[model samples]
Target: MDVAEYTPQELARLQLGFIIREQPQQNADHSGTHASSRKRELQRGQQKARQEMLDDLGVEA
Candidate 1:
């Protein structure tokens, strides 16, 4: 199914999946700076997806 067919919960689940998939590997000894940057990126993506989902559902801020 297309994105337009997905419910808000489904959209959220998909966004969560994306964030999880994008997470840095546990075995990697990345510095705090890199880790924080990656985390910020994922958070931004989640926020954007949530906003889009809310918009699709005709929800107001």
Candidate 2:
């Protein structure tokens, strides 16, 4: 086995992530819990980003 087989791009992918449709379907119930959680996370991130922009503009959150 060679320790020098890794490249920067390959290492980045190892730290990266992606959604698998099958796994969520198999694991989560039919209530779409995983999706709702992801959506909530996304919304929170967006809200935080928007708040940052508003703060920069001296606007109220």
Candidate 3:
């Protein structure tokens, strides 16, 4: 689906799904430190995207 056609709630849901999907696995061991850090960063970005979507909807976060 086109992002421009999504409602704020739909965008937020999509972002949340991304966050969930990208979450670091507890048993992840390859690239140990760097992978964990990168995962953390990506999760933070997903959270920010979700917040932005909520803000666009004028939701009091």
Name the best candidate (by lDDT): 1
RMSD (Cα, Å) for all candidates, in order, is 5.0, 9.8, 4.4
Measured by C-alpha RMSD in angstroms, how accurate is candidate 2? 9.8
Model 3 misplaced stretches (Cα beyond 4 Å): 1-16, 19-31
| lDDT scores in order | 0.74, 0.55, 0.72
Model 1 lDDT-worst window of ten: 22-31
Model 1 scores a TM of: 0.55
Once model 2 is optimally superposed onto the true structure by TM-score, how far is the C-alpha of residue 7 displaced, in angstroms? 30
Model 2 TM-score, 2 decimals: 0.45
Q: How much lDDT does candidate 3 score?
A: 0.72
Task: Flag clash pairs in model 1.
Answer: none
Cα deviation in Å at residue 12, candidate 1? Answer: 7.0
Q: Candidate 3 lDDT, tens digit per residue, 41-61? A: 777877787787788889988
Cα deviation at 45, candidate 2, in Å, is 0.8
The local lDDT score (0 to 100) that residue 34 gets in candidate 1 is 71
For residue 56, model 1's alpha carbon misses the true position, in angstroms, by 0.1
Q: For model 2, how does the per-residue alpha-carbon lDDT over 1-61 read when each residue is reduced to its tens digit? A: 4546866544433333223223356445655777777756655655665576588789986
- Winner of 2 and 3 under TM-score: 3
